[model samples]
Target chain A: MEALVRPKLQEAYEAVKRALECVHFCILIANCEVKYWGRASSKLGRGQRVIMLKQDGSVLVHRPYGYEPVNWQPPGSRLSAELKDGKLVVRAVRLRPWEELVVEVYEVHLLAHCKLRDDARFEMYGSEGDIRDLLANNPELIEKGLKRVEVERKVEGGSIDILFIDERGRLVVVEVKRGTAGAEAVIQLKKYVERLKGELGRDVRGILVAEDLARGVRGLLVREGLEFKKIDLRKLFEVSKEQGASLTHWLTRC
Target chain B: MEALVRPKLQEAYEAVKRALECVHFCILIANCEVKYWGRASSKLGRGQRVIMLKQDGSVLVHRPYGYEPVNWQPPGSRLSAELKDGKLVVRAVRLRPWEELVVEVYEVHLLAHCKLRDDARFEMYGSEGDIRDLLANNPELIEKGLKRVEVERKVEGGSIDILFIDERGRLVVVEVKRGTAGAEAVIQLKKYVERLKGELGRDVRGILVAEDLARGVRGLLVREGLEFKKIDLRKLFEVSKEQGASLTHWLTRC
Candidate 1:
């Protein structure tokens, strides 16, 4: 099995599926591509958006990462980043909904170190904020509550990882995992959101973040009006070193 | 939900399916009681054996062992030992064939300042071997073999903590990990077994001596045929304190 494609399929699944509906998509799993239609979901052919993101130094995974080259191959998904106006612009997705009804959501902390060099392109979380600032200045991002926030909301007995919030003080709960964004993660997030609404009134909302979540996750997200986000360490480092922007300035701008 | 169950399942699975399959029978899993079915394979429950041995402090596991209470829950498994005659007559289940297939095997060596203490009833791992004895006893366990033995056996691994020769003349592997044992211990032992097989062929046998092992690992062992006999660490300490038993008597007892 190709070790590369599994994560990508997981990302797509996270993007497309609803929490309860995800079990249908994940009946049989091999890497990112799941066993649907009685066949293994192989890698997406060229120009595909689902590409597995492999981790190196400074990443964490609670479970072993799964990849298969024999049956499935990750679709070649590339993000295009171009500074539009003053804010970073991206056509990619963020954490999504309906998926939270199944699995656990981790509180992700952005841990980074800076290494500056000459001219290069850059990004923050693949988009939105500038990578340069993330590397050079993090407090600016953290204090603005743009990158991290503390969430106090319950689901059944478990709590949610708040990803983003709005003026109404509503939460965007997110679940981050390093391996395949599974059906469980989708379902878990959904339940979390539902419970959050009951606990914190109807103003609560949520998202799911991962190295790559599955298609089922996405299906759920789209229907539930949630978001899906993937961050690549390789691309993240590349952007931080090359992009021309002050870390604090870029974070503050976002 | 109970932490003890997962590791025990993993252990019971391996010990039955592989290690002592020719001798013991294995049965019972999770919370399910064994009911006679014509199709069932093993007839005994090694889970009790494992739980019993762990209590004796001859084999170590988690501290505060046993299942958690759920409302007005029933009491979990407990081990109480009674020694009769010269041989330790433990009231425990013999490892069943199917059960042998499940408990994952490990080889380890404890390295510290004392001998095993069965009396440390609640200590996750028992007392250690004496520091002086450990220093003095080192040379004999790891006595260098002839050049041909070294050349033919390829003993160029593991920066020698302690060594012993099993019946097959294979270098026995040992390790002492600080804190507790979990999946990492099982994985490390498996790696060592593979290394010995790959590097020394039929010349190396693995032995694990540690303070404790995780309860969940047995589930992983049942099918892999991972074998390493359990060390009665308490006996080791007893032997150290007594200093009267001959090597033949000592080795046979363990």
Candidate 2:
């Protein structure tokens, strides 16, 4: 790892250029102006921003206020740094779509580069797919006497996330969403239900399953004659744990 | 700005603690294990990762490979650093909804802190709203003799983005998407058109307008007897530029 704090412009530029050659993850705190051109063109005036150059050729220029980067270039970009007319210019370009991001640095506050070795596998629980799998395995969690008939059943419009048989022997088309179910999710479930009803020649029940419902979603579901089921992540985790999955140990160890 | 490279765990922990007191944006490259418990539970094993603590109380744990952070806490998280049992521990917690992230550091590679000042206003030229406004003013770009009637007119399902009267004197419901028009956008436009048709007792045309269409979207639009318009962002920018907007100056300066 190498770091320079309040270094000269020439020194900082040389260090960044060297870091890019070695394929190290570089961080630059600089007062700079950024210009991006490609799908659309944008210009950001001179300001202090944190610029990150990743080993995967990704570049992120973040301002102080927001979570999203003001300007970014995705992975597989060609990164180059040069000192032209006493200003360090960092350019990232992609070839196929012809996108370019140029950062002209007038002053450098801090520059650091290091070889990062991150091979850790990230495991996340309670995603939409996880919810679908859990509900498919344990249909009773969604409703009593609900039996899972098929997972991802293909119909006319699209695939049903989970097909279930209710206690009354009626077929149910389930649509699972991770965080919040909105009007779009409701409309999607309606399309799947209508398609299935046309093919099966029977009245198919539609259920929109998600952890939470967005504003006006409940009313939309009600108007469409659909049902909403709230999914509990904690209970899903517990159910997976009882089945002796590795997630239990991972959560408990944490 | 202050930076420490290859420092001892105790010294690095003290530096982080002092930096947190001064509310500086701190960056740490370390081999650490991360655990997050909030809306969901996640566990990441010990590996080298970039940890960023922003002045806005946002924490991002970035692995070396991807654009998104493996673990992140939004703005307004309480950050604290400590050395416990010969290891550095960094924790960030949020009060609302009770979310907590713990980073147990086994080795510190680089630690840097600096006060960042960024107040530049970000300007994006091409967005869904921008496209809608441009089309509302120049409805002929959509179709010849198409006159826009209302912008965001309220209907039964939701607000129509732009309502236009076509050359044939039929009402047109235009749903504008910035990037790619998909199945959801098609459904939303259909709902608006159907609602208007039922209410006004007139034939209404539905048009899905976007920069591009996703796979199968064209076929879906044809099956529904709807229309699809490919929006040209470059042409829109040129039109906005001719109208003497600030976007022209910004792009030209870049």
lDDT of each: 0.30, 0.80
Candidate 2 residue-wise lDDT, A153-252, digit = tens: 9887679999998866899999999878889999999999999888889999999888789997899899999999886665565445334322212211
**lDDT per residue, candidate 1, A214-236, as tens digits?**
76667877677666655443333
| Best-matching candidate per TM-score | 2
Off-target runs (Cα >4 Å) in candidate 1 are A1-155, A235-254, B1-254
- Place model 1 in a CAPRI quality band: incorrect
**For candidate 2, what is the lDDT?**
0.80
Docking class of 2: incorrect
- TM-score of chain B in each prediction: 0.33, 0.57
Report the C-alpha lDDT of model 1 over B1-254, residue by residue, as the tens digit: 00112243334334333322232111111221111111112122211111112211111111011110000100111212222232122222222111111121221111101111111111112323332233224222222220111212233444323445533345665433433445665566566667766765765543344444567665664334444223333233333322332222211122
What share of the reference contacts survives in each candidate? 0.00, 0.49
Question: For model 2, how does the per-residue alpha-carbon lDDT over B44-82 read when each residue is reduced to its tens digit?
Answer: 998998888999888888887555567777677899988
